[model samples]
Target: MPVIVLEASDFTSPLFLVRTLEILSSCITFSLVASLEDSELNNNPSNLHFDTFRIFCMFTWCFFFTLSLLMHILSVIQFHSLIPISWKNLTMTVAVLGALMCCAASVLFPWLIMDKTVSPRPVVAAVASCLTFLAYASESFVLCTQTHEQRGYMGSMPGLLKMFQMSGGCQMIPLVVEVIRELPSGVYMWQMWVTSVSYSVCVLMSLVTLVVIICDFAGRCLLPFDRFLAGFSLMGVLLYMVATVICFTKILQLRELGQQISHESTGLVIMETVVASITLLAYTVDLAFSIKLLCDRGHA
Candidate 1:
């Protein structure tokens, strides 16, 4: 009698399959980015689409996919564990770090658009700036304070806030990519307005949250404003959800708008949108976990 042996490198291992799929998806995203860059996008003021949100999305997508790609490569090389719960998986870390880079890029890209002078829309400029500030605040929170799991007084508030902002900021990249790909179609539509308004509110909420965090760090008198952060963040989540639904779906309203645009780039748009939507789930989960931590803290 012979005993059948299983190894991490065996094709039967789930990790091997997942890594293979990830590599395939990464290549797909890379191909889409490459293909779209050379084509005519509605927002390309010339051949320099890099100065717009569309380019930023493609760059961020590439960066994010590359992170996963590298993780898969490392795992493949080592014949790592097949268990899905392997400690090597850093999905949350990658998501947060990617958001950090993207928010930073958003800040710089605006200045390059339109005669290389200043960002044309004040709203975009303000939202991008505010988002950057929020990302920084969240990073500081994560770096300076202990995670809730590690026994911090604030519980997972720091981590939750960081993930929410990161996720929220990231999902916007996909929407922007899609919208820019179909530019001048629904740019001034109500849904876009809703997006702008929600982001503006998010900026205010992030500012308020930052102030609270700042006071806490300074050992100053803490305000009863923690709930305010929770409230605003909750609202942001809802608003973003509604806005995303409007953008991604082929609703009666958006249907007409999309028809006006050439569908030549539809494949690339769908690819980027799918990428964005998948990443948004990470943000949602992190947000939920953070909220749960806060609740646990309160009950304690």
Candidate 2:
């Protein structure tokens, strides 16, 4: 009897699958951007700022998703060089591509919901959030499967599981905020108040995740810069959350008081304006911090 060994290169390649996923992801990003612009135009005739901001958000999201797609594809290519054409790796590649596509779609929902006739943006946002959740869930599943295969089931660690959950939460909270933002106008004041509360929740989750990552990285002595970046990121999130709550509360109070008294109180109006100003300031700070953190992480 003779013994034989089969190398990874001996297996037939899955070039078509790789190419197909790349094409699909690219097409979805393009479609979502175009649709967002079209939907924005259909919604408002005078609010150019709103339209421009939506376009900007769509572009930013597309850029990130494209980068993520590239990284995933490269990872897959590298993995193929090391291992045979296993179904697990192929499935993981497909899932990553799907997740990227869903994220692209999720980011475009804000513009889609901008159309006044289409009801509040929340309806589209809710669907987008659901899709985003599904994508993260799929990624978590892949990670768990990989862990199980590499180390027997009993070898799984709590920290790894927590990291997965935290990562998923970090990706999910913004989508949740968008969903709340799109809520219908007729909802009770208390229900509308939840929008501000949701912003706080998102900020809290982001901060917690940043802290966990910071602690994890510190324990390994891998990166000190990450801690600095995470700290600033947490500050930005907190400021944004506070500003949102104040601004929304002011706006709601003004609206309710006007409805009940059929008159505008000048002091309340001034306070409302001030809150809006503070909100803008907070947003600027948050944006600056985010850009700095991203640049520091070599992601920008």
Candidate 3:
């Protein structure tokens, strides 16, 4: 039942062009990495070790490529009107979050996989990823700079905070997962378990909050949305604070325990500790914004 619109303006728009670049760059990155993976398999079948960087890069590219392609398809077919979510909000949210994830992939690919002895293929893929990230960022910048009336709620200040919170929470999920995986089975301390749970809950809440806002459920929800945001932001702050404290305390305890933990495991724990502190800071700032928004709504 969907009809094609095929507007010339749509294809020629800056956003459209940027999206094209995103798709192209993602494909190039994926192809390069795939080729490398193939070469590795053919040349060295014995290397069964996990390559987290390779898988992460491939997943990031594949996800964004598919998402961007879907958006383009929906636009050409004029399917926005039929969707329950705000099309503009959905697109802008994709742009913002895609940019963040792509940037992280770009950084991690080189840091984890590349060195002076490495081949040029991964380097090229990394460059392509960086270009893809820039393309997404360009689209985000254009959408964000548009008039408030033209842009959706996702482009606003509080909305941007939501994006940051969501992205930050997402970034932490991998770190927590890595830490938990690295920790020896049946040896994870209470601190580690509590920290992991807290991180998971915070990330889940952030994702739900973003989804509610982007779907324009803010006004229609049972509880007042601003109050919900304020309350959740406060909860996130507390959760991250506790996670950070426990993470650091565990690191110290590990030092005292000594010789029982692998250096790589300790490093993973330290990385999570640092990231938890940073996420805590982000939540604290978001809490301030949420409080201000709540107060303004109360006055209105």
Candidate 4:
């Protein structure tokens, strides 16, 4: 959830300056998961695990992005040894957070992708996902309020905007939906309810972040496409929230109707992938903005 938006000058390598590390890592994971789903979903009727496969892909995306991020942060240490202690500490914190998130993705994906009923405590999984999301949301809030002088170029609206977009996968919104989908028969009703609350809270924060961004733009225009993408990403988030909540509500309805699990697939689960793809594009826009900022504003 903690943001680590690297400026063009933040890295010694030209690769990271263009966001090549982030883009390539995300593409590799997305392609891998998509390939597995296409090959294994239909023919193996008894083992249709597309939902978990999607969740795995989402985790993989976050893992790789964070890994690239960590690599970039560490790479800075070798090039800028005389940088301020505060900057050094910031890099260390970012690297540590990245490593922890990667570890979480690695640990959770195996159980989530397992064929059998592996979800014993759905509340725990839901809490973990929501916590990560809230961290991202909180980070967005910080960036929205901070200025360029505070943390260099990353303190601008672009930081908030890009992070809000990235939250599509960063928050594991779809992952929570999938985890609820795969809840074992023995999963407690109260736990499910708790997870539902967590989901709603995250959606609420997403909207709130959008509101904050809009308000900031009303007073001071930051740059091109600043508020545009912020509002755009939130609209997508709102739609995803509505669709996901409806789908989740249907699952609860089926439960009350004496159905253990709903066999019918919700369109929203598929919609999540679309939303994520669009968010990825939003990130590309952010990368472009960062580059222009580096050239125009001059990186600190």
Q: Please report, as a residue range, the 10-residue window in candidate 3 with the lowest summed lDDT.
A: 41-50
The C-alpha lDDT values of all candidates are 0.48, 0.43, 0.79, 0.45
CA error at residue 297 for candidate 3, angstroms: 2.6
lDDT of 4 by residue, 138-222 (tens): 4334433444554432345464444445345444554555546655554545644544564455456445444444334323444
Cα-based TM-score, every candidate:
0.43, 0.39, 0.87, 0.34
lDDT of 1 by residue, 125-165 (tens): 33443343344344334433544434332234454454446
Q: Clash totals for all models, in order?
A: 0, 1, 0, 0
Model 3 residue pairs with clashes: none
Q: Rank the candidates by TM-score, best first.
A: 3, 1, 2, 4
Cα lDDT, model 3, residue 139? 93
lDDT of 2 at 63: 50
For model 2, how does the per-residue alpha-carbon lDDT over 1-300 read when each residue is reduced to its tens digit? 332434465333343334334445444544544554345336554432344334444553455346546645545455434433333333343344345434534544444454443433345443544444354445535445555554221123422322232233333333333323333344334633553454455446444543544333334444564454345445545644554565466457657655443232323234333533443354345446546656777854
Candidate 3 segments whose C-alpha is farther than 4 A from its true place: 1-6, 38-50, 184-188, 257-260
lDDT of 4 at 123: 28
Candidate 3 is scored at a TM of 0.87
**Given candidate 2, what's the lDDT at residue 146?**
57
Q: Which ten-residue region of model 4 has the weakest summed lDDT?
A: 88-97
